[model samples]
Target: MGSPSSLKLGVQICGVGYGWGEWRHPDVPADASISLNFYRQQAQLAEAGRLDFLFIADSLHIHEKSNPHYLNRFEPLTLLSALATVTEHIGLVATASVSYTEPFNLARQLASLDHLSGGRAGWNVVTSWLSGTADNFGKAEHPPHRVRYYMAREHLSVVKGLWDSWEDDAFVRDKPSGEFFLPSKLHRLDHNGEFFRVKGPLNIARSPQGQPVIFQGGTSVEGREFAAGHADVVFLNPESLTEAQWRYQDIKGRAACLGRNLQQVQVLANIRPVVGRTASEVEQRYQHICQFITLEDALVTLGRPFNDHDFSRYPLDEPFPDVGDLGREHLQGHSEHIKQVARDEKLTLRQTAWRFALPQREFTGTPEQLADRLEHWFQQGAADGFVINPWPGGLQHFVELVIPELQRRGLFRREYSGHTLRDHLQLSTPINRYAPRRELI
Candidate 1:
């Protein structure tokens, strides 16, 4: 068995609504959120950088009271599905909420994407954290966490079952009799469970990556167990090297106990960086980005992801209530981040109240600094690799800036490895588990 830490560097892109104000930055091309051209160009850049894959974060529901800056974007799976046509090699990762989507429809879509991209598709499996989305799906409020997770467990089992519906030799293309498929090759999954009743073989055949590389996040007790048992990748929000190392080992250990291969799974924490020629200049650029941001908007968005405190009427620079007693239950997976802010910036109860509210952007430093940080993260086990979680509109800057430095330092790939997304990630072509490995040993 290989070590989980042996995994290579990976990157994921998030448009958790408009992504940050970098969307308006000078180099940021407008409409990337909805433009296929914009997405293809970005994928091309990552492919060129020899990065593993391109991941897009998604949400099932929109905030009923969302601000203008946070709304307006295309759906992830559809956009990446379209992207399957333009880019050849970069892995296309999309977010699909387990709570809202059906296993059959999702299985077909993901398998189709895998077939379309020749096996480079991945799904970020998520038990979403939104009551608003539940309402849209005809619920008065979000179901309890335990109930939703219960459903997630069953949904995932069904999706995997459908993915394995056909055995590898199931598609015997016989020309003489004009028979295209072998029925015995199919495995009927008549799954009737607590939350769902799914019957039989999936509409599409098995995907290239077996099941699209299952990526999951949600650092709560429920999340860790799910990732350990099923996820191939964990995109996390650990705040330091110490915390990340613990998470990586803990997750791998749990997987081992579950009788799953730990080597194939990975832990990729979020890393946002601003690259510049000099550390001082990088700080300046970071300051500039921070200055243009509206504190009110940050407060509003922060309200959702962080403290959940209503900062609508509060002064940005004034003392605010402290979040000293917050936990994952209260803040989702952002508690680590909230504490880190307080420590790094030396804030008081009033000052520490704002999350990254520094009027400053998170990733600001010289190319060398960024590279050093990347190396530090890799060496320290902060992550096996990092999912480049840049603020929106900052893509051009990072590509133009830090990417070259990473290449120079031998931390990033210089070119793509294969034609399909799965190939780039070094994942094997999934054989129908319904069918045994056909090749002779």
Candidate 2:
């Protein structure tokens, strides 16, 4: 496997830092999640850095145990729409779920965002992981892990079909003939599947990219297949270089097996890099950040992947309990990883929770050191690019210090080459399915 010549960077724009204790930091505002001004600042900062995109992660359900950032945050598409007017040449990717929402509405909304942003929209397709999320959606019970993927596959097909409702040259406004749009160019998606039935013709015209880019984060067996088959971009979180390289190969190989272009399928790893000017300063910053992590909060945060399984119930000092198949129904891939790590290391309950609460040390260093690691990962085929974690102060440090280092090395772009998200990712524009077939006369 070969790596892309240049690295693509996407910043996760969130109000507070990513950790549970980050809100209590002196530099971070407690209300930053709800503040529009804070979000706008983050977006503009990412754009000024010549980064590829701004990613907004979201979920529908929350309880007292939810992380501070998730407890209060902007609805993704709404927030992205607002940010679209303020920024140019940056892709706006929103996380939305397929399990609860109707295909027609989602297709129309994402397509509208593409139009509003002049074609910089991307949808990070997700199947809601939190079990309590079913309550808000009025479902009797949460769908099983396998069932969710099945539903997602059908939902995506319906949405894509709706996006093709109008051909590219369908609308020709002519005052002389009083013609608005050619009737032959309009098509309806009469879709019936195991999960959802959507009859369309999306009301709006096709967006600038034909269809907004499809982003998927799938780590499980079924998920990997779904992502490899359909997604234009895949987001991942691997704890080590070996794991990263393995995942990168697996995803690219899967796409190849499906007769998909490897280049069109981009894999991005999520990284939270904590940087400082000097080695001492870096250690000081790392320690200062570590102070904010309370043991109680870490336990709560750690429970999320297991469908909020209360780790509090287990003895803090005892070996991590074996709850057989406990999280099989929710966040299957993540929960299993946590269990495997706990077993391998023989960590206690508290140790396991704390391990996940803190950011990995591989990404924490001086700016030059951080740049070298990123360059190494890029050249070694561990990732095509990286999604920077949203930690306000750390984000500022990275853009100010590390971005220039990478740019100087010719490892990242100094300016955006095109207007659309597809352009940044180097993906081709899709042909309209309903366009008329040309004939030789």
Candidate 3:
């Protein structure tokens, strides 16, 4: 078994937090979603706990029925840039869609972030899932799953090429010589692919960590392949321990098959913990949060991946509606997952909706108990780490209660040991593409 110190942890600074009913909680501040101070505090707290990174999830477009955080929130890169000044050790990860954004612009922004944050920036690569997103982007319809994934591969290739535009010692800035940069070190990326044609070097110089770390989230065949080839960390939402273990093996195996070191790619699963000091307290807190979800809220929550297909039109008692091919084009992975759950559970429309509103899987119990479960998962090869979606008041509980327990058990770090995000994750600094390759005589 690997040492506990090997685990990589991250916290989701998801606007207003993760729970659907979080905003309705009286204890939670009303303006948390829009408040920079809220995010600042969260980032600082995560850093104090020695968490690896703070993840910010984003979407291109939102519907009226969208979640509170999704409806209104700061753009991820912009917000993370502000956070960069306030945080030092913890990594800053933000999601951006390859479908909607241009390669050059995003590459420049992320490289700048990596430079600004001293190499603590990570980009979560995503092909936008929402159907309505196309309308906003001046498209009649969303690209099909295969096409989107194809574009994503080409997009990432271009971005990576641009990131390697300059070598490590490219900018010498020799005062006496009056040479601002070494001309020989500069490299041009003349990328001409099916999806995009990007020519020449990037505007920014090489980042401190070589380039920003790449994070990806998806479970489809193409998604897994993409992650295996490019992603440093793969965010997952496994339903069970067995499933998590299987996925961990599958992804690692795929990467290994592709001639990548298995250790290079870390699989981090998303978990929402409803923790407390005692069983009674945990139950009380869980019930309190669950009470905030109304039927309307549940319907809206379930309808999101289905392209906002209104479930309210159907009778609650009836079996789940056949939303055949409704959002298959837009949100293929998510829509399929939802349908699989409904089929497996034999759930009605109301049941499925409520399931989304009130998630069933939660790490509930004392700090010790939660720590035990986490250690079990780590030892069992279920996960490399967790992308924790802290429940209402859960952030405080995690840092103060859970973190101490994990550290005491030798499962988590008490203080950061390295500066760069890559260093923290035990990943080696990437070699510059323009660096001359040594050949054996």
Top candidate (lDDT): 2
- State the C-alpha lDDT per candidate: 0.69, 0.89, 0.85
On a 0 to 100 scale, what is the lDDT of residue 407 in model 2? 90
C-alpha RMSD by candidate, in order: 3.8, 2.0, 2.0
User: Model 1 over residues 315-424: C-alpha lDDT tens digits?
Assistant: 55644445554444333556556656656676543455444544334346777766677678778766767777665545656777777887777666666645655555
In order of appearance, the predictions have TM-scores of 0.86, 0.97, 0.96
Q: Model 1 lDDT vs. the true structure?
A: 0.69
Better of 1 and 3 by lDDT: 3
Worst 10 residues of 2 by lDDT: 432-441
Residue 113, candidate 2: C-alpha displacement in angstroms: 0.6
The ten-residue window of minimal lDDT in model 3 covers 432-441
Which one wins on TM-score?
2
Winner on lDDT (2 vs 3): 2
Which ranges of candidate 1 are over 4 A from the true structure?
1-7, 14-20, 64-70, 306-309, 313-331, 335-350, 358-363, 419-422, 428-431, 436-441
Tell me which residue pairs clash in candidate 1: 22-393, 120-421, 120-422, 167-435, 274-363, 320-350
